[model samples]
Target chain A: MGKINIIKKLSFTIVILLSSFLFIHIVNSQAELTSPTYKIVDPTVDSGGGRSESTSYSMLSSQGGALDDARLLSASYRIGSGFPNGIQANVPIFRCAESSTDSGSTNCINFPNANGAQGECGIPGCYDRFKVEINPSGNPIDTLYLVAIYNEDTNTQYFLQSDHTLDTTYDINDYMTICELEGKDTRTGSGCETGGDPNWDLSLQSSNVLNANANTNYTVKARALHGDFTESDWGSEAALTTESPTLVFDIDIGTTSAADTDGPYNISFGNLTAGVVNTPANQIWLDLGTNMQNGMTTYVKDLYTGLYNGTDTIPSQSEDLSVDAGSDGGFGLQIGSVAEDALGPLLEGTTYDLATNNIGTVTTSDTEIFSTDTLSTNVGPITNGRGGIILKALAVITTPGGVYTDTLTFTMIGNP
Target chain B: MNKFLFYTIFIFCTVFTFSNVNAQETGAVPTLFNTEPLEIPSEDNLDLIAPIVANEQINIESSIKLSPAVINLERGSSYLLKIENNTNVTKEFTIVKSAFEITSDRKLKKIDDVLEEKLVNELEESIIIEDELLVIEPYQFKNVSIEYKQPILNYLNGVIVKQRDLLENSDENQSKLDFSGQLASVIIDPTLTREQLDQLKNTITIEPEKSFFGIALNSKFKIKTNISNNSAKLLKISGDITLYDGETRIDSKSLTQNYPSYFYPNDEVSIEFDFNKDERSVFNQIGERSAVKTLKINGEVVQISDEIYVLPYKILVLLILLLSTLMITSFLGYRYYKSPKKSK
Candidate 1:
């Protein structure tokens, strides 16, 4: 009887051990995880190695090997070696499949390793860099690495910006939402990626997204997904933000100017915060930091820009905004005067006083109405960027037939 | 009597008659033609003109010393009366022709000239006014100037007559005011019949002078200018006066009311005027001696003043006599006083 009791105890012990072993095998040990990372490590570079529409950028030192050709670094996830597979372990990845909407919802896609690659990023073996060897080793997992690309030189978002005025450091749209790589495609969280997760090939061919504005911050993290219905702690956040020596800022014509008889009224300038967090408005006020002690200048000289066909060394397009009144429609434009009740054109919205800055007089002749006059020495602070006008058109009924319109531009230089 | 002598006498008579006719046409009396026949025998070299005689020259000068100087007029022609100064000395004349007033605007610009008195030139040159007063310097002749017909639209002239003459209480002054307007009437009608124009012509009779042509040196005289409503119609008259001291002219320089003598036709008015001329004939002179050459009274007036008085050489002679008598008396007294025997 004592012998029988010993045998039974042994059987119970073996059963418990086997069951625990099965449980351990199914639950991939994932203890530490870190946030993801995405940015243009080098901000001064253009994708085509040229300063033009194709100018792209990249933050990854050796993105796609030899990071020199890259203009952007796709978002990536990483974790500590505490996970069962360690850093070299394979894992699931999710990405924003579409551009964000006004409501901030996103469509996401789950990358699968269908192309014979070990992990989720793509078929190019970028994901295979992290894996757990079959056996015969002390720890199979070497490093946890999810693949990311450095191909943002499409000139769509931030990288090779269409406007050559500024180079992009980072774009919020570049940072995509990532799921814990659930079974198949059961993404739980609602974020800036796809509203509904879709099946994506492990070796994806393209990012297929309309990127975000520059200089915006993105929140990104990663974790391990186990088949045993267990999940590791979220990985360290991908310390996103283009690795630019300077901040990547954006400007937009936030509130369009209202149509007016004389000219446009309030023209507000504000920051362009894409599907990211709600950024503050009024970028104009921010642009003109303290006081614009210097004058707001115009493009052409006061003589007659309209009369000339081409331009001199000083291109009028860069220096000035040509407000053209098509047909026989004269764009009667005049600058502001310092006189409180000046009879001159009323330019510069109420927020700004063009008179505070100097400008040319209003004219209807076949001459471009532009003035490079400087502001008064004592002109006070300039809160907003420039956009306002005063019309010198013929009286309403007396004006010739046709919808008179003008295409003007505002070239602003920071006031010292 | 021989036939040739008879023919000569007849021819001389005829020539003299024609000369008288010309003198009358010139508003001058033919005193030369009316002279008594010379008692000298006639000769072929005698020229046979009435103004010539044996070693003597007939005088030919401005006459009309008589009271009234009549001016004839015709329709559609500017009424003109050519009067000569007659005197050899420079004479200034003032002829005030009542002109219908027309409205006009005037502008003035002030000029500053440090070297000379500031003079202004009128921008507009149309000389339209209510009166056209002319000054005739010696030997110069002038026509009585009047322009445009008064539509009699305003009756302002009649009002002026009522305000002065009609309102005055003196009957003599009232009579003097009666004939004091332009004696010429205008007929402005493109559609008027010939008979109608004739009737309008008879309606205005310009019988200029009336009676008093008498004068004295340094004396006041009366010129009876008759507007004479000889046409039997009531008339309005206005007149002005101008003065001259030989060649120099004196202007009234009045901006308005240039003519103050307005009259209403109630009989007539004898307005008296005084002029003084001091005789100083000792100095050498190139022309005839006269203080005034001609006094051209015109327009609503009958006649200008006529020279009825002449200064003689008596005053110059008197001054000499008085000096001589004083000198003689002084000499006699001195001689008497100097007798030494009487004093001792």
Candidate 2:
């Protein structure tokens, strides 16, 4: 009887042990299973009208020195056949230029200035042709709303307002949704990748629709908008603009007459993150440590492997370095990675490596050497038990004169 | 203790359960995409000599404007219109046609080029919504066409008479809303003299398959005959279709005409038709989707050499569907033995 009882107990133990083992095995297998996907990490910014449809007038800056002078400009709208059969014309909203002068006007050509004068416009008669003689003095270096032109044919007239351009004129921010550049994030959880997700928010960004003068230049800036209690931090102020070396420490630097000196710098990353998590990250990660500036900081890191495989010498993706509020106040990693929205799953325990084949620094004439760092962590903490480790680095841009553009590379390794 | 046995049991159970769902539905409803048929209505008693025109040039003595000529009809309707310029100088004609409303808020794109500005200025000068008909100079054909649903009586009247004209033709316009002229006229014949009845019987034979010039391929014609109570009727009539390849009967078919009972003195009864093409026929491909062909019935000329379209794609698709259905039925029969309920 005693022997029989012992045997029964042993069998029970074996069964329980086997079931537990299988359960653990299934979880482990799931966590280890990750699929990587390629994504368009970043979109390109319009440098200025100078590149493609530049005009001699655009080359003229009012800031003196190498800067060209601002001249009077005119614009008009001829409705195409697509116009609706019947719709009352509504006056367009205008954002006044900051000036108006022979050299340059800070006021918008179509917008009214302080003291009842339209700064951007010099000619007082027709709204279509806003002839404002502009001097380059006191130009708004940040992104400015010039004017929103709405041609309502029914009213046979148009209205103009300054501050209500976005609400009254049209929803310009929604334009990104029509363009393929924007996408969603379809990841499973915080770290683990499922399919993909829609782009976080398309309403925050606005695209330029106005036709710049043949010779005129337009400058734009990216304003940081964060959730409540969130602040923006950068890896390096030097990394804000692609003209790194020339504008290296000069937080305010201009690329052309049409472009303002104050803008976010673009850092390019190569195509290293294939569809699987085993591949490299599209952006090179560097540790800026906990100590960093509040708004925008910069970091330089070297990607040791998988860099040369990129199409051009410069990387393809761009970064939008900002601060993550709830997380530690470090510059939120702004690297464009593979379309996480498209990936199947981003399992934990996956070690994503970095590629450094064609990695280099950008300067006006000469090139500079940079360093890289790598870190790894077990996927944990997150509900999905999938977390990733990121590293960062920094380099001081020295070369001056022309603009600078460079690339960073990294790779990821998934569990077997 | 018995891993192999356990594995076998699992496989057997899975197979059994999956197979025993005897009422399993198979085959999916295939996705079908069909273009809305193009519809071109004939106005002013002008018969459609051709439903579709190709590379051929045409000349119209006087300019013809279709208010909404080219109608992108429902899935089964399509329309096409042609205009020929018989004169010398280049003629400019405006073709105003639009598809179903693509968007609710219709807005035109604003362009700034010289030509665009000129067009805008020109448009600003014109206040009327009438679709302009421009004919280019000499010998150039221009088709003023549009594709749209025929509006209701109220809308049609508005289109015919402008707001200003509505005031001028107020009482006379009352006829516009009258449905008598709106509905097509029909003629019926019965209780006619012996000779008249014979003539009617002979004339009411099956209509040979006919097609419009230069339009569809592999065309099959459906003939409809209407008999009115005022016209003479015959008891028996037989007719045969004669396909002519330049005065030759390549194929033929015969059928006896049937008449409905109790044809009132003025009441009209109509017979509809569905025609199938006879495979054993000889013809050559003429223009795009067109074939030059001719048809006759009972030694009477029904159609001269005209362009007939051979819709090979439609026929091929139909055949594929028929073949697929057969194959699926056979496959289902072969799998019947796999069910355990039946096996037991």
Candidate 3:
């Protein structure tokens, strides 16, 4: 009996210890798995159709370019929209019709041809439209005044008031206008002209203006505005700009090559660039360098990863990341995986922090620089500076394939 | 006995260590933010296009204005009748065709009210109702209709079920019950001239929210029209729904376009869809999670999404399996500790 008791006690103690270990492991894994560390940003609005506060969030755009063919083409019509932080407008909401020419102007209203018309309306694209509601009863003014318009395409979205501008032709299609963010306050039945109409297809009756207080509701429509004229409507009636804490971290894409010589690593299609000024209002863009695929749909999460060659080892595999290249020789390096893109799409202008794994600690007194500010986007390094970190590389096409490569760029605000 | 206990304990430790090593070796690395269905734009040749214009019907007060000034019809057998409106402006309206055939003795035999409506917007519109069984049994058919019309386009269409045709007062109209079906259609009649038999068709457009369907996720529901049409010709009906992950895109086997795609003057098409994340783990729903840590469905634009949330049942089942393994190991430990050389 005493032996049995002893065995039971031992077993109980062992079970308790094992259970505790398993419990801690499970909890840690579960927490790490469920918590979302990244936010998705899209251009949408608040209850009233007004400009949103500055969004500290990131953004992504639908693939923009030519349609399958100017005549009778039925490809996926993707247009650009302003998505601030944490909003995924992936659903195809509206369609747009535009002339097949380079102008991309003179298109019909959203979602036009249902049965697929015969080459009638020209090139087709789509835009995302956001509807907002406003009430101006309590505060001071009877009429609320604000600026509203569909801003142009942005690659890098940032937080700086000086970076804003009123460039009219930024969006895929110049659909919405710079009207009052708040609509005119009017009586229930009175007809009022609500501003933002680039196409002016207001067949629906008027009097629906978004007030500062419960007077009317206006729709700040985001249109992919594809030429099919069969555009979709992203029904977002709330403000997208909300003050949120921003994170900052050193995002570096490293390569492996001999020192003092141009390495195999290419910044040719990279999407990051210097800060952009004179862009549209309420719209942000980030251009890492044009390694992204043309007409290929992109996402917020895809914008979060860093591209590194497998030859250069990363600190940990648990790194929050994603990739789309075609090679896999090293830990992170692969051929098709590192999508090579054209240089034209990645020109926003931002300083890049470039580095390579092959260039070990610089011990020599002799420092080197590429001399020219512009690097050879096609072959060798156009320019490389001392300390090996600050390589002010220009946007170039390194690969023959026009693959646009991009990864998520983040900054963990605090000193880590 | 003490030696046996030590040996069993040693065996358990060895087994646990080996299992841990194996798990680490075979475990797949998890990539973040690769959830959400991939947006693989259809690579098919179906030539699918997006819808142009859309609107929701609100505050509609519609009625059917029948002319020949509400005449009485014969009792037995079904009859084809035409509804004519003498109104001037372009007014939107719905028609509710109901009938009851009386026996030869002038008594009602069977009755069925097939309540349906069509939004007719032109100056005049005509509809045909085929071999409708009005009465229950022993009765042929009687043609009857309840039509109401208001000049404005904002008033909603109203329906009323009546047992007998008694030209009563307007107060009796309150007895009519409102309906859920709202009629939506494009007025496609180009002909005018104050005609009495003009035929107009309903333009129906059906579209899915996303090009691809999600595995174990609610499919993109098809948006449809509610208007009914009997004389309109359905034209230009074709749409393609394609699926794609970051890697490959899969198109629907075929696009189905058989007329009267569910709404009235009926031409709208409807569909709900999702795509398979992995073919290997397709049947393994229990404790089975998507290998795609970051999933993107790219059509024109890439939709980045993630699915780290494992189903509760899957977690529970995994826990149970783990617990069973622990129990079995413990049982063996206990048995070996209690019995010595005799078992050996």
Candidate 4:
């Protein structure tokens, strides 16, 4: 009987110790999670190698917190650091916050308190969605979340937080401060804000973090935060390289309204009579397109000083022609009109307006004709900039009868 | 009826004969004006009286383009200036030559002066452009043969290729603008041998002392010199002539003889200089009274000395009077002596 009792006591003590060990393990593992796996999510793999001024990422973890724990996920991002595996030093870390009731429920959140959403709890704002399963599933449910570092497109759910939402109405100060602080909106005047309506991309902002410099490499990694505020180790890095900027320009001889790429362009003003204004049937068309940040400019020049016919000439000589066509002999070019795409308003030269009859002189030196203030938004069949050249000539009775001629050259340059 | 028919036939014959005579007279007169298009003349022909009508429209697709925007033409060599028309239409082009000068800023400035007749004539004579008017087919190029036959010196000029159009009456109230033209710089770099340069330099000569001996009897002394251009090339002579009495400078005057101031080849010009009152006083102040004329010929200073002996009209009159009195007295005395010996 004494031996049996001793055996029972030993067994009881072993069972009790095993039960305590299991309880401690369960309590400690309630809200713990592994680092999230991340990749470029917005720009698909086939789309320019996921390289852009802005970047969107999706983070996923194989496990979630226990159902009873108020668990949430968060992420931090940096540019040009954390290559291959580990994060580099001195790189700025932009922390993402959990979705709270203060922000509309449109954002993703892990577990909600009685207030229907979790607060950031003095942490940084969430980069984007931080979704977590409300009910824990033992089958390794994925805690998937989407976030954008600097997304200009408002339609996408991964847009940044400081920016105005599509449906929200924000004051001018809110828009200006955010855009200015971000250093992304290069447009001038009222175009800096695009918040109140459906056209979210009207005044889209550029990415300050991912500068998207040409021929540069960038890396991104992600980590997850549990409800207990315990953070996981950073996942492996994803790298991308940006493409070079593009600029293209061409000149064709035709009407301004409809111009083609075919060449052999020439301008002819039929026999100039005295006291009459002579204009050519066709004019030069300048076509330009570029993705350059600061836009482009075009210049024109002539081989001769004026319409020279060996012995006689109708001279312009670098002076604007503002007189009645036939009162005196003069030759010059006037800007007819400019057709531009979304990123447009191509500015005419200072002295080359057709409306004011300020015909620009074509001289032996280069003269600016058309220019733009920002990048070109041209697409297929739509030129970002189109400038027209209307050649005008006037000859008095003294203008010697002959075929006057000149050769014109156009030069285009992209702004830095 | 037979008589009336015969009269009518005779009258008709007379009328027809008179009309034929009139037509023949009209045909005999020289035709001064031409209504049709003038044919392009040869390089040697200077008769450009007829107006050339260029009727072909300028084909913009194939503009007239001259290769080697600057033409380097060496003397005594022939060069081909290629003019291209790359359009699908035939084109008529007129080539013209003009004088130009490079400014201080290295820019071309065209000079069109009717007074520069010698320059125009020299240009026409020195460079022979094979054809002044060209008719080029579509997508074809034509070569203009340029022969620098008579090179004088280095000069820069321009050859303009213009689209040609017929002179047609348009709405007088409206203005007309024609096609574009191209100007090719013609740089005439004459590579003359040393002997040739020396020969050219010696083409001008000045007659020395005897060319201006006699002078007007006045306080203003008139001086003259004969300058001759011995070469076939036209020359422009301009310089100051200084007159010196012994070693003392008397006067200086510019040679201002010709209107357009061009010395024709193989022609002699008498250039005269009239001294002012001050110059005459200076001449009188010199004691020796011998004068020296100094002028520049081909950048070299030349001096010609001449003696001055002036016979005043008053002195000549007194001398003639004295001689007449002597003759008269001698004749009277001889007559008196002979008469007395014979009769008294």
Candidate 5:
């Protein structure tokens, strides 16, 4: 009876040892299983001997073997998906590449091996391309990426799959391998075989994403499905910002003046002979520049209602002065023609066009004189922004002459 | 005898000619002076005819920038006005002070001549500038200190900083287009408090329209109400005249076309309303009825009420004539009855 108990105990010990070994092996295998790697691809770059707008995700075996049998069960991404927060939606990656095609194809394809050999994908840096489409509706161009699902049971990769085909119906037993590509080969003749492509870059558009406004920041992240439909942790967050808008404004003397030192601001209409129209030699020039979408406007007001010398005054006209010599005595301003600088095509106010020689009435109240509807070029060395203002005055025979003067204030506002 | 006469005539002619030449040379008898042709004043000769107005020849350039275009000056306080010379050459600016008032049309009416001598002197003394002349170097700036002393009243005044031509002579004929000086409005804060401002309302006087005594015979009648701003502060006056017949409002009309935007101190505006044919008829009816009529003139600060009697003098005259006729007839009849009966 003692011998029999010893035999049973030895057998129990062997069984325990074998069970422990099996459990440790399973745990080790799980610990070695790593999440897939993901990244955005720049269409402008010639990576993998091709250019395309796509997000690349790798799902290669640990042995660096082909992904012919190892397939992706599902793939998804989210914009402004910073770390710690879970990705809420899935974006499908379309299968644009056929067996005989290269990287130029519009669909997702696997990157070749270091030797530039085909059908030998799944090495490190050999990732499958997920196509991203740019949405042009918003101002900053929001982007939407497509998610793809590969059914390992059917041994088929689905192309152009919509959100409805996410394949969540599959059981967790449907396991798959996930891999990532880290580097691209950049060689002249050898092509992705000898060295990585130095020009290869990544952008938000390549990942099918964009900002809603100029000068705004955005974050992106991606998660991958692995064996048993287990989702790996999200990759490192990718942060970027959109470009900013610019606006510039300046004031200088119009080049039409005989003397540069005399003005850009002040205009003088010399002695007014009775029944004669007199215009200043120089005009006041206003320069403006902006990248604003809505454009800008300029307004002007006068300190005095008319040109006054002591009690004698030359009154401001109610309407645009006829400006005819020997007409009524009046004072006003005329907006000259538009002289475009680098970026131009500014417009004059409807009331004060110099073509008609109609010196528009300037009262104590503010009046619009010049405006523009879009981005304008900076005031260049060659007279730009727009033309200046020409002061016009006419004195009748009865106008008592002294030193007639008035001050005008110009104001400009921009809409960005 | 003919030879003797010829010689005598020749001698006399020669003597007269020599005597005239000698007289002209000796400055005793002057020959009718040969007059040079007069040159008519034309465009070419305008300069000779009259000294060209300096302003006409001047091409005024705005080279200087004056900041703080408007300021509120408190009594016993000082403010500095910055003047920037944008030119490379040295520039001189002259400060000119002028008294100004805002007109009803919102125009700046220079009242330099309208202000009393005492007020003008006070204004000149109250706002004292360190220097009326400012000389700034190339690309330099200068500040003019304006000190407001104890001011007697609030006034809207202007400080005109004119760019002086240092290169030109001061002669009036030396034409130089001077830079039309930039005007900085100096609004002197009133020395009076809110209570004082309210007290000024009592000084406003409104004269009622003249009472209509005679019958309303003309097609139209004039009702004039004179509103005077007797206070020291500027006021905006606007009101209406209401005609009442025994407390029953009959008619009302605006005293003036519009309220004077600025009713300056010591200024009077006449508010006249002309009664049309319909209005005259209403008054005539009132006169015939002998009803109590009142004219009330209302101003912004003052109101005046006066009784106007529009009596029907024509009807009264007719009634008197009728009574006299009846008396005369009765007297004649009595006399006829009392005296010797000469009845027929």
Candidate 6:
């Protein structure tokens, strides 16, 4: 029993030692990371409009403290994906003060606490969230990086200017920023950050400026400045793209390089039955693309020919021939939809779906077109950069046919 | 459990919260001044012609004239000299630059110590003197924009132009024309103030100010400049800023970056460059820290506006501790709320 008592006492001593060590560890750990821990949870910056002034964006720190102010250490816009350190160091670094309290006000961030729903620094009276500004690149910046460092002033920040942060060492419980050789004014925003926001991007309004155009795609990335020498991990990347890729859009008549002005868009549907429709001569290629995502469309109209006999004009009731753009790459033009574009006199009961009769298949609509900057456009029944339209003349069994012809206008209208 | 968790969170806020600071440096380095996004000029418009007229001494019977009968130029600047072709016919004129002989007479003009010199030698070493004959098209003039990349010996210079017509592409027979020895004298003058080029000075004005240069800390300074463009078209211009310590020239930075900026007419742009001495500092260190008495910017129109200040390290030490204590307490209270038993 006496031996048992000794063991018990030893166990108790070990427990006490462990507790003391853990308590010290918690305190020490806090101090080590106390040099303003932060993250640009979302570092993807998107410049809505291409301007020459400071473009703004904000990110509230998730768990760390407040960033009273941040100096723009460096910001550069480079082409391709790789970034060179200080490549654009010559560009002016604009100041972006923390906007933890009011969205509109530049003042108000001072504390470091996380509340239930609101971030201690992300919301009110805290430095967890920072409002950053990008200085003038002057040129249109579509794909680039913006590095900003958070400035910490222990005196102005936490009222510890008396604490010589750089030259002196403090206990784990202290709350002073240890900048270079100064007291409370610790400068932590001087490091070079190479790993950027993978999704960093910028899209310009016009191609004339900085080679940015409606078809261009840009990426943007950023990171938060940490300790007097540390930098937080890069945040998420922002993308700047409005149009679908030029490769996704495809159109082919008989040839891929034909244009609307070419005479290759002609289709002739032989005699049609009262209840049976004849096949089309040829089908127009298509990939009716998505809106702005793909691009705009243009339909060029040359002329419309009314169906006529060698001598007499056909009656309006007998005009039953019609044609329009195909629905898919394989299908020809829809021969006789009720609303189909047409000009002729024939039986009222005859209609043709280009795919079924096979005179000419109606592929998808030509929504996939190119922007105006494209040089030497392709000429085809359907072209991504340039395009043309083809029409076929169809006739009913009772209708008179002397080779009635009508011109189909191919039009391309772009997205806003 | 709730009590422990709440206390833990509260402790987290107290021990692990708040601000981080950044670093910066400044000192005047030759800075490149860039223009804000202004209107882009038409393709037809070009930079200053140095002379307003295409030809100054054209014979009444001749169809060409060198714009400025007499020319004055600055060092390390790009100049656009025009060879005018006034005739309606599509004519091509070939200029022999080797034939550009310097006159024996030396004239004197003084604007600065660096700009005082003789005229004859300036002509012989003129950067604008090309090796081949320059061609000028009909009705449209051609300009030779020579950019002097090196420092030049200050002097006044003179050159008389001689030309021949290229008869290859034209059907007109080669006619004997004595277009030689016309006095198109150039005064390769760097003196821009008293002797004026009204075409540029009257159209563009640049006012520069050195806001401040730091002493002990990492070198830093702000160059605040206002460039006013009064002409009709946008200006695509690049300039350099330099630092000088009493007569010793320090360093220079080419404002060639962010090139071809559009400077619209009637626009005044405010440019502030907060520069720091890292590798780009123009001034050498006095004792690990660079000190300078005068800062010079030689780009655009040179007018110096200087501001200097030293940092105050004393007040930074004597902080109102009570005021700081009060503010810190208030902020800490707001950051760490009383965690209820239910918050776990």
Question: CA lDDT of A255 in candidate 1?
Answer: 24
- Compared with the true structure, what per-residue lDDT tens digits does model 5 show for residues A346-408? 678776775555677776665667665533442111113545777777778888867776666
Model 6, A46-79: lDDT tens digits are 1111111224733221111111112211232211
lDDT of each: 0.24, 0.23, 0.23, 0.42, 0.41, 0.28
**Model 4 alpha-carbon drift over 4 Å, by segment:** A1-210, A217-219, A224-229, A232-241, A317-328, A356-358, A374-383, B1-344
Taking the tens digit of each residue's C-alpha lDDT, what string does model 3 give over B309-332?
A: 222344455678999999999998
Tens-digit lDDT track of model 4 for B36-152: 111212332222112211112222322334433333345677666666665555667677665544333222334434423558776777777789999988668788887766643
- What ranges in model 6 sit over 4 Å off? A1-224, A228-263, A270-276, A286-294, A298-302, A305-394, B1-344
Worst 10 residues of 4 chain B by lDDT: B29-38
lDDT of 1 by residue, A186-271 (tens): 22332213433443322122122112222223333333332333333332222222110010001122322321111111221122
Which of 4 and 5 is the better model by DockQ?
4
Off by over 4 Å in 3: A1-135, A139-416, B1-262, B271-314, B317-321, B334-344
lDDT by residue (B94-191, candidate 2, tens digit) is 33221111111111111212333444433333222234455445445333222323321101101111011111222221111100000000011112
Quickly count the clashes in candidate 4. 13
> Which window of ten consecutive residues has the lowest lDDT sum in model 3 chain A?
A242-251
What's each prediction's clash count?
A: 56, 150, 164, 13, 25, 83
**Tens-place lDDT digits, model 2, residues A74-122:** 1221111110101112111112221112113222222222211111111
RMSD of each: 64.6, 41.7, 38.9, 47.8, 47.3, 30.7
TM-scores for all candidates: the values are 0.15, 0.13, 0.16, 0.33, 0.30, 0.21
Candidates 3 and 4 compared: the better one by TM-score is: 4
Off by over 4 Å in 2: A1-89, A95-206, A209-416, B1-344
The DockQ assigned to candidate 3 is 0.01
Worst 10 residues of 5 chain A by lDDT: A117-126
Could you give candidate 1's per-residue lDDT for residues B1-344 as a string of tens digits? 24544554565456544433332222211212221211121342122211111111111221101000111122233333333333333333233222112111110001112211211122111112233343444445555443323322221110000001111132321101010111111112122233322322111111112222322222222322222222222222333333333453322111012221211223343333333222335232112222221211222222232223332234435657898898898888787788786577
Compute DockQ for each candidate against the true complex: 0.00, 0.01, 0.01, 0.01, 0.00, 0.01
Chain B alone, TM-score of each model?
0.22, 0.21, 0.20, 0.35, 0.36, 0.26
Better of 1 and 2 by TM-score: 1
